[model samples]
Target: MPSQPPIPPLLSPYLSTAPSASLTLLTSTLGATSNWLILRFICAALKNTSSEDGSTKGDNEATTVVLVSWLRDATFWKDGGRKLGINFQKVHIIDALTTGLGIGASSLADVETEILKAITTAKPTTRVEGEERVLLVLDGLDFLLAATSCSTLETLDLVGELREHVYTTLLTSAADLPLTQSPTTPLEISHTALIMTMVHQARLVMSAKSLDTGVARDVSGVLRICKGAGAGDKAQEGEGELEEREFLYFVGADGGVRVFERGA
Candidate 1:
């Protein structure tokens, strides 16, 4: 186990906080996966679930995570969670990769059904006092578009429907240059459209990609966090837009991730 906590102090504000009724978008690449960052979101949200004496907190401070993945298995996330001292078994999992959502018109519906089912039948530990806010994490949703023939709009509708059941929704997808900049094929077009639409709807957008200066012993990649189109709706009465921030992060051999501002 690593000595450091999963949620770094500098990254806590952005990783731990998820506004209610908002969407957060996480963009990653094959070279710089966001799995590490996603785990921090889980840790931070559930951090206040219990007090020092192991007593359950009220609904106001509790959070439950429901993870649905199309590109990875439950074990992959669970094992990672363990390294962070988190019990990922408590996280509701919808394994699209294993069960297969299938192709065509009904795929999106099936996706939505699975997610709602998970939330409906979650364990008691996940529901504090009465109702605990759920953070629905959808990993690799773009894979659904490429694997199935569902249009971007249909998949997006599924997103909206899922949001109605959870406090907030976090989505992850590949945003490589080809998919976002030079999309030409049908699959690419749909993937790009879906990502673009989500960006406009998301309150926070965090993008992870490899460093342009190449790999280094102390640096893993660069992470960019910015407010989205929906952010302005929640801004203070006289406040300006939220500032976009960037950081450099490194993942250690012991599965501990360190996220810090540039040059720190």
Candidate 2:
């Protein structure tokens, strides 16, 4: 294993916050634009239930879809703080990377459950046909690598567990599309467009695409799924664009830690 180089201080705006009893949070400094775009999308998805007629209802029953961000990056928080907007009553930003990884085993499940509960509680009083999605945005997984002491294999196992749980849950409830799959494959398509649409509406916040080698596989799969779901066609017709990343960690084939970034 190799030591992690000091993360450039200039990049602090993008990384998660360091460990602390309390953080000096500056909401005004955060990047609110991305967060606002996401919020608006969620609102739009909920408001408009029809893809053909493009009809929508009022925002009277609209509830804030909980935004769960996992990152130790101050920039992510800052951006979120500034952009989360008035659509949400509360924003729970966990600043400590160490605490997030320490609780990593259960954190994914807990977050997923909380989002589902929030959505269920909202109950939009109409059949949510194409998609009814809850977006889970994760930033700064690089920090997760820094925080986790486990071997690379162990980390992969943990991540796999989280992925399985989420995919299974979404499939069972027919909620949301799994967008990371390749957009060209037919087998990957499902009735998850509303989920993908809502996620897009939420400004592309879910980090389901971790950059492990498996991440490539996942991305390929999601592309296939989304393409199969007609997302590719839709996107081409000026409907949307795909902005997903592959997951990566600081480990190798032999479970050794190393610092590397994509396109480097």
Candidate 3:
């Protein structure tokens, strides 16, 4: 378990300053999913614990979060969130995993409507008082391609529209060999299109997978962070491109993650 912050130092900047109108893609293989990392993001975002780098914030300072999980139920997140002291009241979770999102283009539109409603529930009336910073998180949205009849382009459009209402967007999906290597099947092809298109739109790309060199006693997996196609378009004044980097991470039984440079 980590003794420091839940958000490892290596990832803090990107999480805090991911530009608006951008996306952050968390790609995971079957052997190493990004659910654990997503939780850390949620923990930092909701309760947030601290921005002083050492101190904490009052309830009023919390960031509004809209979570849409297509692969896990409400119980799974609530239970895990409890471990991290997440304030569930501040988080709006849309659980599409338990039931179903239906099975066609119209169904996809209905799904989109539900997501928009959840995002704006707090201040549906206005942005006049001030702009609210709401983060939108979608876990396993790729599941839609396989479960429904929607095309990849249509699903991507849904993501684009959702980004309009939120402060930032982060999503997780499969990036296994078949999908990333050279997808050939219809589903794989669509899934690959979804991921690659996102890469072109995401400012930060965080991918997790087992060590290619095989098993290790201390390391469970590796993480790679790199700027995506979207990063270049949104570079702020004096802020240059982020250096590409990698780290080895170990997840403890207690569910804390420790990330560090290799050979550290």
- Highest-scoring model, TM-score: 3
TM-score of 1: 0.88
List candidate 1 stretches off by more than 4 Å: 49-61, 102-106, 123-131, 237-242
Q: How well does candidate 3 score on lDDT at residue 244? A: 82
Clash-forming residue pairs, model 1: none
- Would you list the C-alpha lDDT of every candidate in the order shown? 0.78, 0.30, 0.78
Locate the minimum summed-lDDT window of 10 residues in model 1.
51-60
Assess every candidate by TM-score: 0.88, 0.32, 0.90
lDDT accuracy of residue 161 in candidate 2: 43
The residue-level lDDT of candidate 3 at 140 comes to 84
> Considering lDDT, which of the candidate structures 1 and 2 is the better prediction for this target?
1
Q: What does the lDDT come to for candidate 2?
A: 0.30
* Model 3 spans > 4 angstroms off: 1-4, 47-62, 102-106, 123-128, 237-241
Clashes of each: 0, 39, 0
